[model samples]
Target chain A: MDLIQKSLLQQVAGLHDVPEGAYNIRVNGQLDSRNTTANIDIVTKEDKPGIDIIIKPGTKNESVHIPVLLSKSGLQDMVYNDFYIGEDCDVTIVAGCGIHNCGVDTSKHDGIHTFYIGKNAKVKYIERHYGEGDGNGENIMNPETIVHLEEGASMEMETTQIKGIDSTVRKTGGDLKDNASLEIREKIMTHGKQYAKTDFVVDLNGKGCSANVVSRSVARDQSRQEFFSTINGNNECKGHSECDAIIMDSASVSASPKLTANNIDANLIHEAAIGKIAGEQLVKLMTLGLTEAEAEEQIINGFLK
Target chain B: MDLIQKSLLQQVAGLHDVPEGAYNIRVNGQLDSRNTTANIDIVTKEDKPGIDIIIKPGTKNESVHIPVLLSKSGLQDMVYNDFYIGEDCDVTIVAGCGIHNCGVDTSKHDGIHTFYIGKNAKVKYIERHYGEGDGNGENIMNPETIVHLEEGASMEMETTQIKGIDSTVRKTGGDLKDNASLEIREKIMTHGKQYAKTDFVVDLNGKGCSANVVSRSVARDQSRQEFFSTINGNNECKGHSECDAIIMDSASVSASPKLTANNIDANLIHEAAIGKIAGEQLVKLMTLGLTEAEAEEQIINGFLK
Candidate 1:
């Protein structure tokens, strides 16, 4: 990998060098590096432009890193990645994408990821999207995530998009079986004239199943954002979804959360809030000798922390 | 007062039998009783169908009660009441209105109140609106409040509307001078087919002026609600506004909060949120053997508490 690609990897995946354990690095829509451990296997698909990561049963304390970097402007990249976890395994997956476009044409990436977890398996997924460039072109990313959890399985996913993405549409869907759980945390910030749209749908299909999805975002300048989430409780299950946003300057935000309960014991709820930074918060910070702009920056940093 | 009139008074205000420093009771469309103290005076207006309440300067530890009751159906009553608060005084004003409609026609009340607070004075105002009847008639209320605060003055207002009102339009406006402050807390609940609308505009017109406005509401059973609040920081001042609501069972709520900062030192913010109760709250209560309905009711009660 070149210096720019390595820098992009550091920015998106926190990888300063070659990562440990199973890892796959893709740069400019081509495979740059690949490695596999004793408990994990990474294989390229024959017909598709992606890889399949398979983890052995009972694997513990293992990790996988798949980071993609696009340093070539005007490149349109698409990839399909799938993960399969064996029963009673616990693992962590880090997947991120970064784009450095310094040309006159737009750069775009579309990533489709699907996860299948066995019974009693546990997984934690972290994904970050970032863009940096001095060119007039735009950086755009669209990500789609699908998950299926068996009985006694659990998955926690965290996704963040904080800077330089000119446009994005993110979609996530999950289905949980008996005693299974799914949790998702999403954080996004849009500045300039950027636009962001997020959609999430989770279904609790069996008794004792639960799902929780929460999103926090900030929109500044003339940026616009829309968040839509729906939770369906089809049995004796619990589901909740929440969206919170901070609006600044001429920014606009709209949130719609819907909940459905199809059974007597099913319970579902949803909440959404959109607003600006509280005056009292700013005043308290300003009283501590910080300028208004400094106070605002501190508040936003803490909020997105 | 008759038994029904007394009961209405008790419901709107905390009055069993009026015994206070100064009080005025209006039943239906006429005056029921009036009393005054050495420092506080309540006089019937000669040009209108309301009263003027005047408090002497330097007065302390005084209270006033002006409660209005409407028990006659098909009656549309409109009155203009004004308050003149003297400088260096500390006072509490209890004002409320109750309507009991037991006929086939609509009962409506329009109360227009204007307050002039002098310099260095402090005031607390509480107002509650309630309606109860078994007939097919609808109950409607339109309340308008205008406030002007002099230098170094402060006012805190609490208003509530919980039950039985079929429709309402509440409007409040305030202007704050140098070193003046205003705080408002509004709570409302709408059930059945009831409709409620609230509008608030506050202007911080001088140096060191500030304003804070907050509203909490619950909409249930097809009820509709709209909340609009605007805070203008025209000088070296601070302003904030917020609207929070819960929507349930086909209920719809829309909130629009705006902030304007005209001066370099002006700080302004606004926030709004609308959603449903949390499912975990219900599950927690249900684990204690409470029914879902009971848990829901308890959550709503505590939220509006």
Candidate 2:
């Protein structure tokens, strides 16, 4: 195995070897797609350097893991990945990006993803963006994702970006049909003048559609961040957005959460908060003989987890 | 009675007669220091137009109500009031300011208050700042308050400013000694391009001191607001700060709550949030036959109260 694959697996999949040919892996604009299980297949896009995943109707019990890696500095990777899950299918996908910058120039990745869920389908997706380098190059990621859920469909996403990234802009939105539900849980951490801005908009377009967006972030040193989330209700739906951040030193954070209800039965609520780590939490650990820095590290790990 | 006196009585005291000489009242810039007890006396400052009240030792069962008023438009008033609370004393002070502007020019008021509480003194202070006018003049107020609590002393302050003020900047700070505690509850509401900024800094300088500062605000129709609070813990102390705001109709708000601890036993926490009104809250009220405006008004009243 090459250094690229080794680092990618460790950072993203947390595995030693590939999923025994049951998954797809993309490395430096190269794609390796395998395992045609009669109902699920990965096809390369004709127009772009990306992949198109299709799940046939009634397909079930399929798990796919795709980890993308950007290993060289001055390299920029862009992928447009789309997923089409048919009716009554249940699947899980583990997707992530790992970047290793080793030069003076910046290493950036832009992952644009779209998901289409058929009626009564259930999808669980997890994505982690990790950056690790000792060079002066900046590790940047800008992810744009959109989800379309049919009636009775449900989608749950867990997205995390913890440490090592210098800059990021994440945009995620979803449109839910009747009886459909969507939930996103995001965690972010930045330090040493790093900047991150995350924007989210969820539209409850049909009756009984529900959406919830929850985020936790930590900004240290001179890092800066902005979080904006808006939930628009068009029917008898329920929506809620929440953001919590910890700021230290000269760090700054701005959290703008808004909820708009157009129908009389629509219900939406939003909340955001920006502050420092609790002193009591640190003291509790200190009483157990941990240093302040150790206590902060433990707290951040717990918060992000 | 003169028109100024009538307006002052109605605006500040909420009375037709002037307390029938039973209480101390300050109308506009005049000081009425009457009904002096052997333990409590209100005296005019030698260098300033304001007054100072000195409470001798063993003073108990004394209450003071002094509501300042700014009735004339284009008129600015500045007052410096000081209170010396003696040991073993229990007192309640109701101090507030009301402005009725009705002119083309701006009317302003600045109040600087200081309190010195001795050991075992329990003080309950309530202050409300209100502005009401139908004119083009801007009603502005800047208040600076400092509290010094000795050992075994406790203080509770309830401050509110709900309507008609165009602009304000409020700054409050307190220093607590051993076994001293301070709590502040602030409520503010603004509309129609009004602006307000509140800053608080509490220092828990002695052992066993605790402090809590909580604020709630409503900003509507392009109004702007900012709330900044920081509690510094230096000993075996406890501190907490919280801020909640409701933003509507293009209004904007920024809340920054912070805590700093220098001792191993210090414990501090802060939380803040900003968003629009929840749709379910409105629906619950509207189901009782109230219109949207009526429902919103009811919610705001309940929240601010």
Candidate 3:
């Protein structure tokens, strides 16, 4: 891989060099490098432009990295990835995409990922999106994620969009069976004339199931953001969703969270808040010898951290 | 004052007995006790059912307490109080109302407070509302506050509604002149089928003027709450408004904050957020041996603190 691809990998997936264990690196719409371990298998899809990841039963302490980079301008990339986890397995999956467009044409990427987990399995998934360049073109990304958790299965997802993406539409959905659980944390930041929209829905379908979803974002300059979340409790379960955002300059933000409980014992709640930095907070930081701009930057960094 | 009135005073204004300095206590729609100091004068209004409080110029470190209580159900009371603060004075004002109705009819109180602060003066105002009873009667309160801050003047206002009020509507407005500033903090909590609404508007009409308004609230059971705030920066000034709320059970909350910056140097922002207790927060507390309910209580207490 080139230095630009290596830097993109570092920024999105925290890869310092050629990683150990199972890994796949894609650059400019083609696979650049691939590796597989004893407990993990990575196979390229024969009919489409993606890969299939299979984890053996009882697999533990293993991880797989699938990071993609687009260095060519005017490139439109679409990929489909599927993950199948065996029962009693515990593993981690890291997937992300980065775009560097320095031309007059727009560059776009759409990713669709689906996860099927067996009973009593546990998986931790992390995905990050980033774009950077000094160009007149735009960077756009649309990612859709679907999850199905079997009985006693659990999943934790952390997704982030760092910077430079001009537009994005992120959609995520999950279904939890008996004794299953799902947790998701999302973070995003938009600046300039950029726009971002996110939609999340979760269904608790069996007894003792639960789901928690939280999103934190910041919008600056003329950027705009909209967040929508829904939680449906179809059994004796628990669900919660929340969205928190900060607006600066002429930016705008809107949040709507809905909850539906079909059972008397199903507990569901949602909360959303959009606002600017607090005067007291800024004053307190300025009293510690920081300027107004510095204090604002510190506050935003801390909030998005 | 009687025992019931004294208890109500304690709950609303933290007055265990006759307060020091100037004070006026009203119970059952009549004056129960009155006192005045050399620097502060309290006189009953001849044209209305309220009092006029006048503070002398340079009246340093002086304070006044005006508390009202209603013990009889089926009563509707309205009062208008005006305050005149002389130039260069620094004072504190404590005002609150409490209702303890144990009958079959609703008890209500409507208070209108207007303040005319002189040039270069400073003031700190605190107000609290509370209601309690075991009967079928409802407690209702509607309080309105208007302030005119002169050049170089400043004021900080803190208002709170503790509990048991079945319905309430609170409105506050402020106007700031050159080099003047205003700050307001409000807190409210509603349970059962209670309803609460709050509206705030502040105009920064002069150079170097600023205003900040913030509200925190919690809704439980089937309660509902609505918060609306508008900040108009008409000159080279700064303004901000925010609302934060918690929703539980079948409760609902909505917040809308608007900002208008007419001048190029006018800086304005607003923020709002509503949700229930976080799952991770509860789990962290449960790890310390507390139950889920106890953890939620502790979190709510800390958030409101």
Q: Write the per-residue lDDT of candidate 3 for residues A246-277, one digit (tens) a residue.
A: 77787766665556554445666555555678
The ten-residue window of minimal lDDT in model 1 chain A covers A256-265
The residue-by-residue lDDT of candidate 3 on B1-305, one tens digit each, is 77888899999889899899999998889998999999999999999899999999889899999999999987899999999999999999999999999998999999999999999999999999999888599999999999999998999999999698999999999999999999999999989999898989898898999998988887889887878777777776877777777777877666656555444456665655556666799999999999998998898888777
Best to worst by DockQ, what's the order?
2, 1, 3
Each model's C-alpha lDDT?
0.87, 0.81, 0.87
Instruction: Give the Å shift of residue A13 in candidate 1.
Output: 2.7
Tens-digit lDDT track of model 2 for A33-126: 4565678888889998788888888887787777888887888889999999999999988888988887889998999999999999999998
Stretches off by above 4 angstroms in model 3 are A1-86, A103-119, A142-160, A168-305, B1-87, B110-120, B142-163, B168-305
Candidate 3, overall lDDT? Answer: 0.87
Model 1 residue A101 distance off true place after TM-score fit, in angstroms: 2.2
Tens-digit per-residue lDDT, B185-230, candidate 1: 9999999999999999898897999999988988888888877777
Model 2 chain B: lowest-lDDT 10 consecutive positions = B19-28
lDDT of 1 by residue, A176-215 (tens): 9999999999999999999999989888897899998988
The residue-by-residue lDDT of candidate 2 on B62-152, one tens digit each, is 7777777777788888889899999988887777788878787788888888999999899988887878777589999888889999999
